[model samples]
Structure formats: C-alpha cells, structure tokens
Target: MWKVVVESKNQEQIRHLVFVDGINGRIRLHFDMVETSLRRKVYDNYNNPALGLPGYGPVRVEGGAATGVRDVDLAYEYMGDFYYFFKNNFNRDSYDGRGAELVATVRYCESYDDCPYDNDFWSSTKRQIVLGDGTVTDDCVGHELGHAVTDYTAGLCYFMQSGAINESYSDIWGEFIDLTNGKGNDSSSYRWYLFEDDKYGASRNMANPNIFEQPQRMTDYYYYCGIGDNGGVHINSGVGNKAAYLITDGGYFNGYSVRGLGLTKAAQIYYETLTHLLVSGSDYLDLYHALYQACMNLIGRFGITQNDCENVRYATLATEMNRTSTYCVYPKAPICDVGEPVDIFYDDVEGKEYWKLTPVTMLVLPKYLYSSEYARSGKYSLYGENLDVLSDFAISMKKGVSLPVGSALYFHFEHAYDFESEGSTMYDGGIVEYSIDGGRTWYDAGPMIINNGYDGVIYTGAGNPLSGRYAYTGTSFGFTSSRLNISSLAGRNVKFRFRIGNDEAYADDGWYIDNVRIYMCQVKIVDLTGYWVSVKQTCGRTSRCTIKGKFVVQNTGTSNSSAFKIRFYLSNDTIFSSDDLFLKEYSIKSLKSNTSKAISFNVKLTSGLNAAMRHVIAVVDADNVVNETNENNNLLPSVPFL
Candidate 1:
C-alpha cells in the first residue's frame, strides 16, 4: 500500500514520519526540519496577519488530512531522503496505483549556507544532499528533481560529459515541464522571457543559451554560477547545453546544421549517449569517442553519414585534447575538475580558522572573436588581499557606457559558514559593501545580513553603489554588497573593494565568498572577433630561442569594428632562473568576418638566451597565457633536458 506521509520530529535531527494517501493519488512529502537554517530559521508555523501567510520562514508542504488544511506548521524534509526512498524502496513493481512513498529529511547543517537549494553535498548519500540554505532558485527544485530522474532513468551512474548533457537534459525537460504544467510558457514564450514572476523563474532556453550569459560560449541555463552545489554542475553544464541548443536549432556561428536536431531527436541522442556511451569526466576527446557511438546507435541499421557528426568533428578540432600515454604525469592533477583554479589563503587571528576561499572568473566576449573584446574593453582588473584571506570569489561585473537614472544589477551569492561545531560565528562582516567612487567610499546596497545563503543581495548602483555585498562583521552585519552598477560608471575607471574595514581580508577563521559579481546598467555591445594571424615556429640562435618562436604569437584578427589589439607577451622559464623574462605587448586591430587574420608577434631572446628552453604557446589573449605576475598552482620547475 502506498501513502502520503507527514510526521513531526525534534526538528534538530533527521527523522522519517511516513503516512499513506490512497484517496488522492498525491505523493505527500514531509520531514523534521532542523532549527538551523541557511540564513533564517523556521520559528514555527503560526498563522500571520501581515500577509496572512503562515510562518516567518519557508514551510513544509501541507497535505490533505495528512498534516492539515493550514499552510504554516512548517516541517523538515530534504531532497536526499526522497531520492533515497525512491531509489532504494520506491519501485514500479511495488506500486499499487496509490500515492508514491517518497521519504525525505530537512536541512541538517552545512559548512556553507549556499543558495536556497544549494546543497554542499558534504558527501553524496542516498539520503540527503546536506544543503545550508543557499539561494536555491525555484528552477533548482526541478533541477534537483531532474537529478532524481536521471538517478533512476539513467541508472544513476554519473556520466561525465554526459553529466553536463544530463544537466542540460534536466534544465530542458524541467523547463518544459514547468511550461507544460502552467508554471511557465512554452515555445510561444521567448527563451529570453521570464515565466515565473517574483519567484525563481524559468529553467532553460532551447533557442539561445547565450541569453543572460556571462561569457560568449555559455548559456543562461548554467554558467558562472557560485560553486555551492555539487562542484558547479549547473555552471559547467552550458558546454553540453550549447550542444543541445545547436542540436535542436542550428548554431549562431558554429557553422553547422543544428536545424534538424529537434527535441525528440536531441532527447533520443542524449539519452543514448548518457546511459550507454560516456563515462564520468570523459574529457573532450572522450566525448568525441562517446558521441560517435551515440550517433551510430541512434541511426541503427538504417544508415548514418559524416554530415550527421559534423558537430562532433568540430568539437575534436577545437579540443585542448592533451592526453598522456599513461595517466601518470609528474604531480598528478585530478582527472575531473571545474574551471581554472586560484588558491585562496585564510589566516586565523581570533583563535578561529577560515578554512578555504576559492575564486572563479567568468568573462564573456563576442562569439568566435576574442582579441577584439580584449582590446576594446581595455579590460584590466585590480584585486588585493591575496596575502592570506578567506575572501575569494569569482567576481562577475558588467560594463555599460549608458544608463538612465535607474538600472538594475544583481550578484549571485551564498554564505559558506555553519560555525557552531567549529566554535565560530560564521565570521563577521556578514555584509558586502560596494563603492561607486572608485573605491574611495563604499555604501551597502545589497541584502541585509543573514547566516544562510538564501539571502542573495540585489543592489542597484542606480544612483548608489550597486548590487554588492560580503561579510563585514558576523553579528552586527549580514552581508556587504560587493556588486556595483556600471551606467555612468562604465569605462570610467571604477574601483571596487569587496571586503570591508576591520576584518581580515582572507583570514583562516572567516567566511568564503563565491560567485561575486558586478553588472552593467544597460546592455552594451561586445565583440571578440580575432584569431591567430598565423603560427610561426622558429629556432632562434639558442635551442630555447626555437622554443620561444614555437610559443610566440604571429597573426591575429583582421581589423574591423570588432578590433583586436595584439599585445604579445613572453615569459622566462625562470621559476628559479637567474634573471626575469617579461613578454611585451603590441596591437593589431583588423577583424573581418570569416577569416583568420595574420597577426605577427615576435619573441625576444633575453640575454639569458637559448639554454633554458622550457615550453611555448601563443593564444588570442592573456587569460589562457600564464607568466610571472600571474600565480598559477600548476606551474612547475623547468624539467632539465635529458
């Protein structure tokens, strides 16, 4: 017999209280919610007269006769428990047409109060995801539900490239479900339109993933999101999502036929690829392998051709596909990781320790054009407090040259602190402050202070600073606004200070900030069209000189409205070299469509000449190129020639 059960517990520990609801076929869910909340707590479910809303905080789903007709009386239930029962206990053969038995637990406690539904995944268990109340947008509910579905339908085996594909699947299907069920709009609704108003609206956009995206390649479905839940599953999924978009509808500039690949076809292809073809963390090359198989399977005995796998071919040519014969390199880096990494050190002053703070950056440019944006923006960022602080977050900011008086900007945020077991108060400076006066003075513009991550600050630099906040002091303040507006501030050489006064910028005993952002007051045109003019590999007088030429930049984009300033630079292999090597910069702005303009950049043979030849590579810009000032953990000592 199946039922909809809702039970009461101590509200401190995870407990199960199940009941049956056969009369209604509704699978009622309930659990004991802990007193601990991400930012706020569920005091009680007393009816309120203010808005006639039941409790002060979020509530449990009130069922028919199961709980009561009232909505207050919040209960504790979690996503893990429901997933757990569904996976282990709830089976199709066991069903009797009654309401399904889906048990769950409420939030226990976590290292960080991530976004609303942002679960830290202290560890992936069959029971709970262990979230700390981050900003789990309503979209997340279905996203998580999609995970449950993948867990069951796909046999829950963690497919790598397929994982991103699976994620896109969720976003696609979830958004589809939302629109189909009257929650949002369907094809009639623009993928750019917001369906759910005043709530965590919209899920995915099949039309354009680039809409509301931070960078050129990613989609609004996921990219540049704060890393609170399961190692950025949402953020990185755009890679596969774009594939889905292109598969459904032809690409914008990908120069491939994505028209014929609609939802029916996409779902068929992805389901096969995820469930049967790919493995977890199957690098780009691996994706080439897996998808090739998926395409074959999809065509079956009928037939297939090169045109069908054109996207797959393009992916191969674009891969940074470096594979070692043996999986053993010097100091082995983990197989699967997200984004470029930067170490964030935190020091302890008041006998408390700030664990870790990692920063991730997401910069958007025009599609297929890199150098043009790099030069047009004259983009340079200034960051301090790298000395030793727990404050490290990928700061995202939009640049705008025009603005009325009122414009909006938002920063996605989450507080990563529980502090009780660690005997800390989640660190002070619970606020983030923003400055429009180029860092001279800063005023709080984001949300008020709270312990959990649910309180994402939305501050407009409209006339004020902007949507920016970070922890200033634990008790007195919640979070300070670190986001800023860019209407009149755009290209004005603005300055920003993330952490406020009196607090250790990045101390061991402080809170960690992730997904920091600054947005434009209005949409601005961005063009990043540029390519390597031509690659030249020459051996200077020294053997090292040869390597230098192999690594130097030659040609870039041809000049056009979207121009690229070719600032070529070179660096010495001297982690311990006697002298220094600083690659210089130059400009070449000639960008035209459908062409790889020849950009010539020469290498300088420093006095320390040819002996110390390490390695060389020429990229469009400096983001991927590393040198002296830029501290990267992956840099290694020059391997002396055998």
Candidate 2:
C-alpha cells in the first residue's frame, strides 16, 4: 500500500527521499545537508555552550534534538537574544559578567500531582530557571533570565519597594527583548504588552498598567500595600514599568512631559542603574537617583545628549519614583498655630507614642525596657537595657514627622544613662540617629548636636557593635537636657531613633529618655503687608482698556517669608471680599524679614463696570500656604485708575 525511497551520497549527507501511497500518490522530500549542518554547527557553538544542562528531547539529532522541543527552543532562543543584547549594548559578558552558563529546566513541575505547572520562576536557591508549560512565552523566558541578571547585579532584596523594583527590572528587560528580537510582533500596540504571544493573551501593559489593575504612578489609588506577593512586588512593579515605557516612547504623564530615547539608549541607562548605582536596600527614590546618575554618566558616550538626561528625569517624575514616602501614603504635617512657637513633633512617652523597638540581632533578651520608674517631666520614660551581651538595638518613632519650611528647628530631649565603662574607656553606650527616608536608613546626629554633645567614643576593642562611634556614655547623675539644631533637615519628612550597643562583658542600669520634642524657637510667621498699588491704563482702538499695576509687599515677621501668591480684584470699595471680581494672580519668591518685593500685573477690563468708579485691590498670600502673623493686613488699599 505504501513505498519508501531514499537517495544519499553518504551517511552524513542525505539528499532526497520519496514516499508513495497507493491512494494519495507520491510525496517528495528535499533535504539540504549544507544548511542543516550549518544550523547544527551554529547551535553547537553558540546556544549549546550557554546552557548548563541538556534540554528535554526525543532524540531527533545529536545536539539538534534539544532544539527541536518547542519550549526548550524558545528558552534557548530568548536566552541567546538577551545575551547578545547585553553583550553588544553594555559590554557585559553574561548575567554574571563572567560568561557563566545559563541554567534552565523546561516543563518544570513541583510534583506529579502538580504536573504542567502554570508559572515560571527564577529559583533563588538553585540560581536557575524553572519554566512552566502554560507561561513559557518569549517575554516570560526573558523575564526569568532577567531575574538571574538582577541576582548577579543589584541583588535587590525581594520585599517591599526593593522587591517591586526587582520585578520591574525583569519586566523592562523582557519587554525590551520582545520588541527588538526581530520575531513575533513588535508593533506599537503589542510592543508594550508583556506575554502578548502567550496563549492567554497579554498579562500586563507597561504603557498603562491600570488596564491590569496595577499602579502606573506611585500615588495611584490601586497601589497595593498588602503582605502577599512579597509586599505587592508584582502590583507595584507597574510604576517602574510605566517609567521604562515612557523613557523609551515619550509621553505626558502625571504632569510631566518626557521625550523618548530609543531602545538602546534607554536600555543603557537601566543597565548602568542595575549594575552600578543600586544596592540591596535601594527603593524607588534610590532608583530615581540611580537613573539620574546613569544618565549623567552616559552623557558623552553612545551619542547621549543632555536632552536624554532631562527626559530620564521627566520619566522618573512622571512615575513618581522621586517620592520618598511609601506608595499611596501621603503624610501631611499639622498646620502650625498662629502667634506661638510651632512644636513640629512631641512625645512625652506617656502612652500616646508610636515608637517601635527593633533588635539588630537574634538575641533573646528584651532590649526595650519602657517603664514608669524614670521620668524627666512625665510619669513614664523609654528605657533600654545594657544587659544584653554583644547586642545592638534601637527604638524609633514609627511615623515620620515633617519639618516645616522657613524656620530653624531643634531636637530637644532629656536622657540619663548608666553605661558600663572602664577608666576613660566606654564599653556600652547609646547614640541618636535620624532617617530622612522613613526609617529605611539612619545617619548619625552627632554633627547636628549643639548642646550636651556626645560624652565620649565607645571603646573599639571591647567587641561592641557600635565601637569607635561617639555616643552618650557614663553616668549623667540625673536627667540632662540635650539639644540639637536640626535646621538643615527642614522641609523633609524625618524619623528619629535612639540606638544602644553593648559589649560582651559588664552590665549596667541602662539608659532612660523622656520629654522628646522637635520645636522651632522662633515662629517663622509671614506677615505679608501690601504697601501700595499704583495703577495705569492702556486703551486700544476697540474701546477695550488694559489696566496695569505694581504692588509692593513687605515681610514684617521675625523670620524670612517663603514664596507666596498675590491676587488682584476689582471692587466698588477699598475692602477686598470674596464677592469682588477677580482679575489676575502673580507669584512672589521668598523675601527676607524686613524686606520688600514689588510685583507687576496686567488685567484687561472685560466686564461692563463703570471705569471711573471701579477700584483695584491687591491681596497677598491669597492661597494661605504661608502662616502669617497678621492675616488681616495682607490687603492693599484699593486705588483708582489714573
């Protein structure tokens, strides 16, 4: 019924064959030995050398059989794509910078019960990739390998903001490879979508993440903050994804306009960020700085211009990566009361405080010893024990306090400690630190301390964790007032903490703190006194008149006044009210105390009011953003048109 024929020059060089069927007629096959041998040689030399292990196969050829498997072929193809991309773009050898072989297992299942697993992941423990059956698209393969690259480079911690950044880097690389791979779809509508070629359609759109319930910007309402998915790593990654997309395809988003840099330039910026400018604990804010630094570094290389750097900045701004606070969390400082010194933050330690204690190590001893036994002005005080051996611990304010602008602030506290000490050498001690990034990192406050400075340095040879650092040690006899001038940290959200480190030997009665307060000594009140308003008019041939005036505003407060706004109104009387016809608004920069600024404005008379009877009134600080000492004096006397 069927007949088979083969024609060959040798065992290695098959030429042609014919399959004959009784009813279906003859089917001829032609094989090109040169092309097949060349493809096999190329795969053997390039792709096979990059793989750490043999791929799944049905033995179609010696090395070509592995490439015959669909999923295995996709994995090897994209891995080679990523390799060439980074090698040619950034001069990177491989994911590890050492030309290490990439390891991947396709059709990976956790167990026989869970066969045909539905996902792919980069095994952090194994340092390899495990591909599932249902999600092995090109971008997915590239995404998993991208994780390997991140592991070898930034090594960003997989939690919270850092975790989100990790996920976003993978997505960015995956999408980039997908767009430039010269296979599948690379159109505008499909380029920004991850997993577009998968059987289930696209899973995410980097240009507009809100289409898949992800936050395109940091302050979006859909930002996830839950504990699952490693603190919303997958959800919040959309912020960085949107940033990458905007950087590559320029758009207006979140009040910022970015000019698109092509894929190579954008990829260079991100590669520099991931490889050079980031750390394990870096967050979105750090990512912004890293991107900026990367752009600056690449200004002259590869034809990168200043405009590219500015577009990078605009992209970060559009994604709100410059925000220092947590995603979707807006912290507003309390408005300062008028006519009194503003207490920016106060904690008497009498039970209404939100202080959190964290131990630096795995010691079982209780470090925080908050008790009612010691107090400077209250019934309670925060205490930390010096009994823990070779221990470092800290108690920090859970919520950050925003320092208002235009004022000098002070950190005031009363504390006493009985630290272990030898003759002129301290073994146990405590120090004050402040964090500008919501307690993610802390810096020493010793440079800012003005009164009652650090007693001495902790002995370096005593095995104390905070050895060689200046701290409060020895007996203070009783509670002593400590003052620090923290005016440099104004206009920033900051958190404070007290850290104590002890050596392995002696124990003492510990440290006690009470009556902590951050206050401004002199209230920076902005008394906007409008001195005068001089008006003139220009009449056109159409009977329309343009009125122009120069209004002088004086800052009569004890301290400098910040930037404020001025509004012009046309009224029947000299008094300014809400019912008056608003004309125009002007912005005024900061003015020192006892200084004056003259601002000019022009308004065309459009309404049918009697020109001779109308009076122009000027009001300063119209938005009330500035705290003023004399709010009623902001209105200038109405002047008649000359």
Best by lDDT: 2
lDDT of 1 by residue, 269-374 (tens): 5556655654322333444566656776767422344555665444322221222112211111221122222211111112122212223222221122011100
Candidate 2 lDDT, tens digit per residue, 1-642? 454545455332344445555686756443443222111111121222233323333222224545556666766666677777776676566677676566667666665565556677887676567776646676887788798888888777576677889999999999888888897778777879999886668989999999999999887877886556866889999999999999999999989999999888999999999888876546787789889899999998877898899999999998988874453322222223333456878888888466878775435345455855555433567887887478888878889999988777888887767789867889999999999998888999999987777888999997898899999986654345678888899999999988889998888778878778898766455687876657777776666778777878888876788788888888878987789988888887787888888878777788444446568887888888888777888788556765
Compute the lDDT for candidate 2. Answer: 0.75
| Clash number for each model | 100, 0
Q: Kindly give the stretch of ten consecutive residues in candidate 2 with the minimal lDDT sum.
A: 37-46
Deviating ranges (above 4 Å) for candidate 1? 1-139, 150-169, 179-183, 192-207, 214-232, 300-642
lDDT of 1: 0.34
Per-residue lDDT for 423 in model 2? 72
Whole-model lDDT values for every prediction? 0.34, 0.75
C-alpha positional error of residue 302 in candidate 2 after TM-score superposition, expressed in Å:
1.3
